[model samples]
Target: MPVQQLRSGDHAFVSYADDDAGREVVTTFTWTGLARHEKVMVFSSPRTDESEVWNSLDAPGPLLGAARERGQLVVSSMRALIHPAPHFTPERQWQRIEEETGRALEEGYRGLRTYIDMHWVADLDADIAVMMHRESHAQHLFTDRPYTEICAYDSRSFAPDVLTAMHRAHPCRLLSRLGELHVEQTPGTVYLAGEADVATREQFLSAVREGLLRTADERRLTLDMSQLIFLSAACAVDLLRLAAASEDHGIRALCHPTGVRILRMAGAENMPNLLLSEVTR
Candidate 1:
C-alpha cells in the first residue's frame, strides 16, 4: 500500500532493496505525518549516520526546517530511546513507546508516528524471537490512541526466512514505492488509480479478482476507475473476461468517458454481467 493510506493505529512493515528506495518511503512518510500534525520520529539504522537521515529529509523548502525547530520532527536512534536500560527488552521498549505516545498527545499533537529500522535488532544483539514477539504483541500501543509505526527492514540485512516472518508480524505492509499504478479494495469495491497498461496488467487483474471474490455474495461489485488516468485495452479485456467468468454477480465499472470507450472497444457491451457507467469529470 502507498504510505499515504496508512492511518493512526497502523503498524506497517516495509522492505527496501536499496537506500534510494528506503529514502523515498521515509521521506514521504515523514512529510505525510508532519502534514497530518502528528509528531514524527525516525530511528535511523544502526549503521546509518544521523546526519544522513537529516539530509534525506531536507528538501528544497522550509517545512522540514520549521518542523525541526518546533521539535515536531526528531531524528534519533534506538540506543538513545532505551537509554538507562542496559539492553533491549520488549518491556522496556514498550514502556518507552507508551510514554512517548502520551507525551506527544500532551504536546497537543494528534498522535505520534515512528519509522524504525529493524537493523536495530542486530545492533542491540537482541534475540529474533523476542523482537518478533514485540512486533506481534505491540497492538496495545495503538488500540484506541492515535499512534502509527513503520518497521523498515533492509533486504540485505536479514535472511529470507526472517524477513518473511517480520512481514507477517505487522498488521500492514507498505509498498516499496509508489510506482506507475496503485490499487486498493474496500468491502464491495476496487479502486484503481494511475496508469493501467501491460506494465500493470497483473496488478490490475489481481485487485479485480480479489474484489470479485469479496463481493461474490452481494448483488453488485463496483470497479471504481474514475481516478484512473490511463487504461490499456488489454486490461479492459481482462476486466471483461473476469466479469464473463463470474456470471452470477454483476460488475459495475464506474469510469471516465475514455475508459468507457476503451472497454466498449474491448467488447464490454457484449458481456451481460458487466455494466460500464461513465463518470463525469
Candidate 2:
C-alpha cells in the first residue's frame, strides 16, 4: 500500500537516499490524502525546491488543483516549520500540529496528514537527542486520533547512527529490513508484502490489529504473505500472538516456504484456529 493508506492513527518514518525519491514519497502520500478527503501538509527541505515539489505532484491536475483551491493542501518548507523561535522545542511544535489537525476537522476534511522533511535537523545543528525523544513519544498523539504523519529523513544527510536510532523510535516504517510493507484488506483476506523483522515489530502488530478491525470473528481471515520475502524471530512471535488470540476471529496466514518453517519452529502449529498455508516453490 502507498504510505497514505496507512491507518489514520499511524506515525510512520520514511528514509530516502535521494531528492527525487523523497519527492516521490511525499507526492504519492499527499495525492492519496487528497483522494481520501483528508487535508494534506508537506514540509520540503532546501534541497527539494518548493516549485519542483509542486510540479512533481503534477501541478494543476484537477484533484490537486481542486484541493489547493479548497485549502486542503498546504505545502511549507523546513524553514517555515522551524523559524521565528530562537530554539526548537518539540513540545511547542507538536502543539501547533495538534491545533492544525483540529482545524482541518472543523474545515470538513476527513482527517489531517503531514509529512516533514528532517534534513533541517542536520542543517540547523539541532539537538538529535531531543529530536529522538520527541519522535519516540509522538506515538501518544496518534492513539485513537485521526492524525497521521510521515517523518522523512534524508539518508545522505543524516548520519548512519542517527538513521538507525530514528528507525527504533518510529512505530511504522516505510522501509526496513522487511523491504516495504503494504498491508491491504480484501473481501476475506489480508495480504502482506515486504519484510518483517525486529525493526518492524510494532508495525507487524499494528497490521494484525488493522486486519482484525476490518474483519469479523465469524469468518476466517486469510493472511496472504506470498510477497513477503523475510520474517524475523521477533516478528514471528508477534504474528503468532495475533493468530492465537484470533481464535474466535479465525486466521489463515499464507506464507512463503521459509515462513512456514519459521512458524512451525516457533510452535505456532500448536495454536488453534490459526492455519498456515505454505507457498510452494
Candidate 3:
C-alpha cells in the first residue's frame, strides 16, 4: 500500500534490484499502484526493460480508467546509484524533479508526479542531506528605505522592464504576511498600507521614520491608507506623533475610501496635513 500521507504533488525516489524480483516489483507498482489511481512520474535506470508494461498500459484495462482520471507521469532514465551513498546527493535529484515540475506547471499542467530510481538499498544519510538542500527561496519585491541605496530605484523614470530587472536582481524575499503591505515610493508620492494593531503601528512608524529621514535627501513621499484595517488607540496616537516629528519632510499621507472612514471614526478627519483622496480599487 502507498503512504497515505504521500500527497499527489509530491516527488519521490524509488529503487530496486535488477533481477526478476526488481522487475516484478516495478511492474506491480506500475500496474496496481501508481498507474491505477495516482499521477506518478518515474525516472529509472537505463537497464530496466519497462517497454512491455508501457505497451500494456495503452490498451483498455482495469487500471486505465483510474490512470486517465489523474495526471500522467513522466518516466525518465538516470544513472544507477551505488550503495552507501552520502545523504546530500539526493538533493540534486530532487532539484531536477522540481525544475521539471515547474516546467510542467508553466506549460499548463496543473498536476504532476515524479519518481526517481536510486538503485541503492541504503543512503539514508545522503537522502536526508539532499532533502535538506531542497529548500527553496521565494521571489519578492520590496522598496528600498532611504538609507539603503541598493533598493533605491526611480520608479517614475524606471521603465517597466528596468523595474522588473531590479526586482529580479534584489529578490527581496519576505514572508507572505508582509506581501500584503504595499510600501511604494515615488518622487512625488508614497503609498503605504497601514495596519491598526500594535505590530502594524510599529511597521507604519518605521516606514514613516524611513520616509521622514530620507525625504529631504530624496524627494516626494506619499502614504496610501486604503485598506487601513484596525488600529489601536496607542497606534493612532503614534501616527499623530509622526506628523509632529517630521520637520521639513514632504511626506503626504493619502487616505482613500476605507482610510477616510477609519480616520473619521478615530476623530482625526479634520487633520490639515492628512490628504483624503479617491482611488480605484
Candidate 4:
C-alpha cells in the first residue's frame, strides 16, 4: 500500500534494496504528510545520503521546500535523534515521540508523520535485543494517536532476523510488488487493499487466516475492504466460510458495492457471523 492510503496512526516497515527505492519511499511519505497538513520528519539512513533524500523531495515542487522553510518539514540525521545521550532507551525515545506528537498537534498540523531509516541501529552499533524490544513496545504509540511512521530498512545491510523482527513489530507494509494483495491489521479491523485474484488466492488466504489467528481472543472481527479493487468468486466464498466457521465472534466486512454484490451472489447472507456492508463513498 502507498503511504497516501495510510491512516493517521499507522506505523509501517518497508525494506528497500537500493537508494532509488529508498528515496521514492521517503519522498512519497513526506509528500503525503505535507499534503495532509501533517508535520513531516525524516531521519535519513546511514546507507542513504541525506542530500539524495532532499533532492528527491525538493524536486517535486516548491511546496516541500516552502514547508521546510516554515519548519513543517524536518530533516535530521539518525544520530541527531538518537545521540547527545549516554544510552539509547526505548522509554526515553518513546517519551520524546509522544512529546513531539503533542507539539505537532498544538502547532496546528493534522498529525505527525515520520520516516526513520532502520540502518541507524547498525551505525550506532546498538544492541539488537534492546532495539527489537523497543520496536515491539513502540506499537503502543500507533494504537491510538495522531502519529504515523515508516521504518525503512536497507535490505542489503540489515540481518534477516532484524528484518523479520521489524515486520512482526509493525502493523503495515507496502503491497508485495506494486499491485498485488496486501493486508493489514489494526486494533479491531483487518484492512484488505489492492486486488486479489486466483493467482493470489493462497497468499490472500494466508493473510486473512493469520489475521484471524492473531485476533482469536476478541469477540468481534472487522474488516475494511474499501481499497480492494477486485476479488475473485473463490476468495469471496472463502471469506464467507471463514466467517461462518468463527461463529462465536461477530464479523463485519466493509467493502465497495461491487464486493457486496459478489458476496451476495455467493450466498453471503446465509453465512453465520458474517455481515457485509457496502461502502458507497
Top model by TM-score, which number?
1
lDDT, candidates in the order shown: 0.88, 0.78, 0.42, 0.80
1-281 per-residue lDDT for model 4 (tens digits)? 65546778888888888677777768777878888999988988766676776778888555566898888999886567655665677876787788889899999999999888877887777888998888877877877799999888788987898888788888887643334677777877888887768887887788777777777888777888877878889999888788777778778889889999999999998876788889953
The lDDT of model 3 is 0.42
Candidate 1 TM-score, true structure as reference: 0.73
Assess candidate 2 and give its TM-score to the true structure.
0.64
* Model 2 segments more than 4 A misplaced: 1-4, 59-63, 176-281
Ranking by TM-score: 1, 4, 2, 3
Clashes of 1: 0
Show where candidate 4 strays beyond 4 Å: 176-192, 195-225, 229-281
**Candidate 1 — worst ten consecutive residues by lDDT sum?**
56-65
lDDT tens readout by residue for model 3, 1-281: 11211234222222222233333434444443353333445545344455643544444444444444444544444332222323335444445445555564564554344333333212232342232233222111111110100112223333566445434443221111211344655554555653456556666677666766567665445766544444456755666666645534444555545555655565555455554565533
lDDT tens readout by residue for model 1, 51-126: 7788888865455788999889999888889998979999999999999999999999999999999899899999
TM-score-best of 1 and 4:
1
lDDT of 1 at 19: 91
Clashes of each: 0, 1, 11, 1
If both were scored by lDDT, which would come out higher, candidate 3 or candidate 4?
4
TM-score of 4: 0.67
